[model samples]
Target chain A: MTILFLILAVLAIVGASAAMAFRSAVHAILALALAFVSLAILYLSLDAQFVGFTQIIVYVGAVAILAVFAIMMTRSDSAHHHTEVFSKSWLTGLVLAGGVFTVLAWAVLGDKTQHAAADAPAPVTTVTQIGEALMQRYAFPLEIMGLLLTAALIGAVVLAMPLLSNKSGAKSVTKGDAR
Target chain B: MTPLNGYLLLAAFLFSIGLAGALTRRNAILVLAGIELMLNAANLNFIAFWRYGTHPEALTGTMFAIFSISIAAAEAAVGLGLILAVYRHFKTTDLDEIDSLKG
Candidate 1:
């Protein structure tokens, strides 16, 4: 199990770094997909079957497809498209991310987290228990999430509808004038 | 048999990579991808803690991860739609060039 975990973690880390380092946006996205796929495997190994499947279906399937569509739609053939990998503030970003990682590593590797982990009992978290808890114990948050999803979808449609309608309206006016 | 710290350290690395990408990338779509990575890293942390915490049978972490995944999907949809609008107005997806609102 440890060996499997190590391989998956290494694969995910490689994919993530590749995504950050790639110049082409398409290549970055492919690398990101690889990272997410390995992450789903990690979830499965961690005994999170439901979460693992959902990660593949929702993130890998839907979110990545949307990102690809967005990229294709906004593709620029200009010479500067390749240079979008970074900006002047990248050094600041590097420092900030590095600091955050250092703090997190120190905390996780500390004795407190180790003792906490050692105290935990064995678990048998299955999908049925999660389903029951979702409805019975955690119903409120689920309902709120449903509402949030609905609101976001409506907002997306509203945000995109105007430009679309304006184009169709222009076409209709020209056709009417011709008629 | 991997230690909890091992998973936590991995999560930290993933999150930092995501943070760097989100902070530095000029493409809005790539920024969104970075945010997804950050979210996934958080999900991994949650599952790790749930598996290794004192009350592993509580089902909180997995449930939280499921909710997070759903929220991430919604966020991606909305963010992409906004990016589409920005692209239509600006004719480019480069974040550096879309500075008309820089007041």
Candidate 2:
């Protein structure tokens, strides 16, 4: 199990890095999907089946699709036609990323091993436990999240309205010109 | 068999890559992808700590991960909406060129 997890973890990191490095939006999103899948596998190895499923459903299923749709909807033929231009800030990005990685790596490893020699207590997490915890301990935050989603939905509708009206105006103008 | 350190290292690497993408990408959508990567990296850390850390009963990390995912979704929705609006106005998605808002 540990070996499987190690491999998956490596795959996830490599896939995510590749996704970040790619210039093509479509390819980058595809790599992200791969990374999400690998993370879901990692979650399973950790014995969090519910979380793993949620990760796949939310990240891979919904978010990935939404990203692809957004790219397709907004991207022009010219945008997709041009060769990708490498950014001048690539070196700076690499340096900052390297610094963060080194710091986090040190901190994570610096901590003493807390688990004893005894076999890890079997993971006791369940859907019911998580549900109860959310309702009892996290109900307020959950309600807040609902409000946030509602606000986002309304905002999206409002933002799209102008485009819709413009299209309608263009249609009417064409009709008047034909007459 | 993988040790706890292995997962930790992986998470760190993923986070850094995401950070790099966020910094280097000029496209707003790509930048959002980078941010998503960073969030997932944090989620990995949360699960790793839950599996290996001393506090067994504290399911705080998992709960936080769930909340973060929800927020990420909401962020993506609003961001894409804004991107679409910008594209409609300018007929392009290049961040560098969308400078009319700067003044």
Candidate 3:
């Protein structure tokens, strides 16, 4: 179990690093997908079977594909000519991230309760129980989620759709032609 | 067996990587991918806590993870749509190039 967790952790970290390191946009997105898959596997190893499966279906399946489509749609011929992949302030980002990690790791490692809490056995969590809880205890939030998703879907379409109003329509057409 | 702190450390590491990627990447889509990675890391933390925390029968962490995942999906959709719109207006996906808002 420890070995599997280590492998998945390494895979997730490697994939995330590759996503950042790759220059090509498509390759970077693909690497992100790999990271997402490894994270889902980690969820499974944590005995979160439902969440793991949902991660595969939602993240690996939907979000990655959506990103790929967005990339394809936004493609410009000049995109390939870019010299640098990372931003100019990359060192700042790296230093900040490293600092955050160090602080978090120190807090986690120093926590005395975590070591004492290891005596509890892993509890069983089945999908049926989760489903029941969702339908009973979490029904309100579930409905709200459905509403939020619908709103997001509509909002995305509106945001991406071309401006078709009489005043902006011609301008939008000219912009399309320029691209 | 790996202890809870091990998972917490891993989550922290992943979160940091995602933060670095989001801040340092040039492409807007890649930036969004970094955000997704950060969200996943948080989800991992939630599951880790659920697995190891007391009162597992309440399944609070699991429920939080599920809701968070759904919210993240919505966030991704809206963010990508915004990216698409910005791409249309600017004709480029480079982060530095889209600096009209900079005062």
Candidate 4:
């Protein structure tokens, strides 16, 4: 189990880095998908069966596809689209991220409390239990989540709608009018 | 048999990488991807704590992770939609070039 954990962790990290490093937008998105898959596996290893499958279905399935479609719609498909992959302040960002990591790692690993708290036996958190919890204890939040998703869907459609202006007291050309 | 600290460390590393990408990347979509990574790292931490915590029967961590995942999905949809809208207006997705609001 430890060996499996190590492999999955390494794979997840590699995929994440590759996602950031890849110059082509499509390649980066695909790498992100790989990372999401590995994370789902890690959740499975940790006995989170429902979260793992949801990760696969929602993230790898829906989110990745949404990103790809957004990329395609934006017409940013060419590999040579950007001459530079990163911004001018790339070093600053790296340093900031490194500093954050150092602090977090120190706090996590330097304390004995974490290790002391690590010995609990893995709980068998089956999907049925999660379902019951969601339907019973979490029903209100579940309904709120549905409302949020609906709002997001409507907002996305409104935002992505083609820009059409009719304020000049004249019917503008409905299609192929260059902005 | 991985320790809790191991998971915590991995989550930290992943979150850092995501931050770096979000800060440095020029493409808006990649920036969104970075945010997704960070969100996933947080989810991993939640699951890890749930698995290793004293009262796993409470199912708080697992439930929170599930909700976080749902929120992340909604965020991605809206974010990419906004990116598409921005691209239409600017004809480019480069973060550096979309500096019209820069004073």
Candidate 5:
């Protein structure tokens, strides 16, 4: 079980890195989907059934599909047009990322002594326990999250209105001219 | 046997890749994908710590991951809407050519 977990972890890391490195949006999304699945597997290995299922459903099913849809909507027929738009400073990106990684590594390693006790077996965080906490203690935050989702839906409708109107308006203008 | 440090290192590597992608990507949508990767990296760390460091009483990590997933959904909706709006006006989703909004 431990070896299987280790292999999955390594695969997840490699897949995620490939997702980030791929220039093509389509390829990147595919890589991300693989990475998400690997993560779900990792969750299973950790005995986190709920988290694993949710990871598959949310990341692989919903988010990845959304990303693919976005890519399809924006892509043009000509390869030249697509390539022309993605010019950026790759070297600076690498340096900045490396610097951030080094800092995070230091922070994570700094409290090594504090984490030595953590090497022991801890109780598994089950779904029922999490549900109880959500209802009993963090109910307010959960309610707030619902409100936030409502607000986001309203915002999406408002943002989409212009495009919807423009398409219908163009049709009307053409019809009026035909008349 | 896999140690907690192994998970932490994997998380760090994933995060670094996400950082690089977010920094270098020109398309707003792709940048959003990069952000999602970074968020997942953090989520992995949360779950790892919950499994290894604390007792079952600290299920904060699991709850936080759920919340983060919902937030990611909301972000994607708004972001894609903005992308559509930008495409309508500019007739393109290229980030470099979107300078009119810039001061």
Candidate 6:
């Protein structure tokens, strides 16, 4: 089990790095999907069965597919081949990320309590318990989340909706020729 | 069982990688994907801590993960829709090219 977990973690990190490393949008999305799958496996190993499955369905089924659909919809002029990153920008990002990782590594390594925590056997979480908690203690937040999703849906429709008049049609037509 | 530090360090690396992707990438969809990665890393941390924490019976962390996924879904929908809208009006998805709003 430990070896399996380690392998999945390494694979996940590789997939995430590939997501960042790739220049093509399609390839990046593929790598992102791979990372998500590995993460779901990691979650399962940790006994987070419900969350793991949710990760698979949401990330693999919904978000990645949504991104691919968006990519297809907007690929008018071979847009996927666009220069994906700036040289200085990625260097700066790497430097910043490395610094943060060093800090986190230092803190995690220095903590003694974590060693004790790791020895305890992990408890299995049930979907019924999670459901009860959400419906009871977290009922209000759940409703708010539903409301938020509804609002976001409406907002997306509004933003992506083409104007009924000729003016918005003009914007769409002029898009290709516009300098 | 894997060491708690191992999971913690893994989560840290996942977050850092996601941060790099978000900071460096120019493509709007990739940026959103990076943000999703970061969110998932946080979720991983939540589950890990819950698994090893004193109160493993309480499903608070799992509850949070569910909520986070829902929020992320909403964010992706709105963000991609905005990307489509910008592409329609500006004729480009490259953030560098869409500079008219840089007043």
**Could you give the interface RMSD of each candidate, to one decimal?**
1.9, 2.2, 1.6, 1.6, 2.5, 2.0
TM-score of 2: 0.87
Residues A1-179, candidate 1: write the lDDT tens digits.
Answer: 37888999999999999887788877888899999999999999877888999999998899888888888887842234446468668899999999999999887766453335444455777778888999999999999999999999999887755434567588765665366
TM-score to native of every candidate shown: 0.89, 0.87, 0.92, 0.93, 0.86, 0.89
Give every collision pair in model 6: none
Model 6 chain B poorest ten-residue lDDT run: B94-103
Please provide, for model 3 over A14-78, each residue's C-alpha lDDT reduced to its tens digit, 9 standing for 90 to 100. 99999878888788878888989998998887778999999999999999999889988988323
The whole-model lDDT of each prediction reads 0.84, 0.79, 0.87, 0.89, 0.76, 0.84
The superposed Cα distance between candidate 6 and the true structure at residue B28, in angstroms, equals 1.2
Q: Write the per-residue lDDT of candidate 6 for residues B50-71, one digit (tens) a residue.
A: 7877787878778888899999
Choose the strongest candidate by lDDT: 4
**Model 5: per-residue lDDT, tens digit, A1-179?**
26786788778877877777666777878888898899888877766778889989988998899878877776731233546434467679889989988988777666544442434654656678878988988899999999999999889778855524567588765665366
Give one digit per residue, the lDDT tens place, for model 4 in A12-72. Answer: 9999999999989899999999999999999988888899999999999999999999889
Docking class of 3: medium
* TM-scores for chain B, listed for all candidates: 0.94, 0.86, 0.95, 0.95, 0.89, 0.91
2 versus 3: better lDDT goes to: 3
Model 2 chain A weakest lDDT span, ten residues long: A76-85
Model 5, position B47, has a per-residue lDDT of 80
Please state the error at residue A116 of candidate 5 in Å. 6.4
User: If ranked by DockQ, best first, what sequence of candidates would result?
Assistant: 4, 3, 1, 6, 2, 5
Q: Against the hidden true structure, what lDDT does model 4 obtain?
A: 0.89
Q: After superposition, how far is residue A109 of candidate 2 from its true place, in Å?
A: 2.8
lDDT of 3 at B85: 83
lDDT of 6: 0.84
Residue B90 accuracy (lDDT) in model 2: 76
Output the TM-score of candidate 6: 0.89
Predicted candidate 1 versus true structure: per-residue lDDT over B1-103, tens digit per residue: 2478888899999999999999888888888889999999999999988887777678888888899999999999999999988886677787778888842
